[model samples]
Target: MSATTLPIPTDAGDLPGLLWLPEDRDEPVPGLVVLQEIFGLSEYVQQRCADLAALGCAVLAPQLFARLDPPVAGIEDGDDVEAWLAEGMELTSRLPWERAEADAIAALGALRAHGAVDQERVGLLGFCYGGGLAVAAAASAEEEDRPPSALISYYGSALPTLLERAARVEVPSLHHFGTADAFIPSQTVEEIREAVTAGGTREQVRFELHEGAGHAFDNPHPALHHAAASEAAWRLTAGFLAETLFPRS
Candidate 1:
């Protein structure tokens, strides 16, 4: 129940993160990395870390932008958000997406190496930008090190683009998209579905379409949230997590 900020030990540097531990730590806990959206670790992202902790996992959400001024920040949402997101995307454009890929892998590594964490039982959950990070994380390594047992993405950005190189994402990946997404049209969604099926194994990949939600449907911001889509996505994400990462636990 108590959530606190902590440093995530990484070979690159000491990454800053928010740690949420269960009220009862009677046993070693499963590990999880809640990758941030482009907006960074905002209240919504932090709350999600808490939610995962309540599910019995030791969760850490790293401040990936710590090197920048204001180690922790929430991107201001407005007409400015588009520019901010674009600039943020540009910053990461040079950021060796592969390195971010490694960092997600290292997060799981650090958790496993923590001794307090059970390495065998690990998973990742991401949203928006992080959702894409989740898939890249899943696709980044061999089964031994970065074996992402489960994957969940909410209106993941750049998915269709990545589908062009879809073979890279061989792990169990699940996607949720809003039917009315201005960013991704119905035709594009259908194309993405085709790419999903063509890109990898059908049995391991699943897609869900929400009736009337746009991008970032899961977030609670009035300009973005869709009640029905958000609820449905959450239910499906939770179920996927339970089945893939903790099947026998």
Candidate 2:
């Protein structure tokens, strides 16, 4: 299904967001706030949002890159992988982490307040840059006593710096990482696992390591996509959302 443009109210102003709703929406359903990778809300991200909606979710993805000078909603991947990566990284650098984090929380609030969403069942799902934002937002939301019901982060690129706040995020969470990720080494991933899981104390947390998969393995880019790992990660993510947000009655 095609997504409609939704305006998310934030402290700075209304952030543009893309929203997707299930075709058979008879009542309030679980909602998810999808954060974008450094590439912004690209086609791949939009497709993933649609996929979530197909599974009976009210999905909203905020345009984090809109805060830029020219306001880039998304960027197209180019032939030069390094150049494309550098461009994305530069865009993200322009948008301060604090602003992005607040925008993420605002998006969650907007999703919770949406008419089609079950506020209590709202969660957060993000990839790459957004994955890390999801963790930060989840923690901030929890601090404000508005925790999401669930969280699924795929190779959170900023996770290393956000580990300090892990204690505040007690909701059901699933984290996916690549063993061969050059951006985030295996050692750091293990550290992340330890912090999020609290040394195996948190039963509600789940961490998966995708063998041989590099960062952003789910992205369809020729240099990034790992078919086997992507399929497995999506399967796990779908199942996790099913159990946490849309449990069988």
Candidate 3:
């Protein structure tokens, strides 16, 4: 699947994004707005967009780290994982949470407006930092009467602070977490699951916990990757999206 660079309009300016469309563009398909991790729109993220497109959805991932001086795009976890992680964290710190949330919502709007997308069937997916931002966008969208049809979040780092809002997210949602995540405790993950699932229909929320897996288990980096966990999470995510947005009659 080939991806094209496009500009997503935002209040600040045009946010660069990678767009992937399904091969059968004769009809508009479900659209998905993907949020980038702290490392920016790395190869892993772009590949995920392609995977989503292959699964019969249009995907767009905006550059949330574009606020940085040099505009970080893609950074791999080199030999010095700590150094790269720190660089990514620094880039994330420079971006205000409010602005990042707005940018994410803007990306969703752009995807919803695209001619190749089924606006009523659009959704949002994000990882780590983007995961948290997705939650904020969901809340905003709900208030604006433009909520996504579904949401997928992987180990949202700021979920603890957004629990109240999460409880109000009525859309079908799938969340992935690691039991051994050093940054977020297992107890916290449990709390997040409870909060996000609260007040929703019985089948509206799903949480998958990977045993023995740490943070960023899907990154494919030796320091963080867990093949088993990543595969399981992807399977769950793919099934969830298919059922929620492309149900078979």
The model with the greatest lDDT is 2
lDDT, candidate 2, 45-106, per-residue tens: 99999999999999999999999999999998889999999999999999999999999999
The estimated TM-scores of all candidates read 0.85, 0.99, 0.96
lDDT assessment of candidate 1:
0.73
CA deviation > 4 Å runs, candidate 1: 69-72, 76-96, 143-145, 199-201, 247-249
The most accurate candidate by TM-score is 2
The residue-level lDDT of candidate 1 at 65 comes to 66
| CA lDDT of each prediction against the hidden true structure | 0.73, 0.94, 0.89
Candidate 2 lDDT score at position 176: 96
Which digits, one per residue and each the tens of the lDDT, describe model 3 over residues 1-249? 889987999999998988999987777899999998888888888899999999999999988887778787878767898898998888888889999988888998999899888898999999998888898899999999989999999999889899999888889999999998999988888888888888344478898899989988888879989899999999999999989998577
Order of quality (lDDT): 2, 3, 1
Task: Output the worst ten-in-a-row residue range by lDDT, candidate 1.
Answer: 67-76
Tens-digit lDDT track for model 1 on 137-162? 76665445557656677776767667
TM-score of structure candidate 1:
0.85
Return the TM-score for candidate 3, rounded to 2 decimals.
0.96
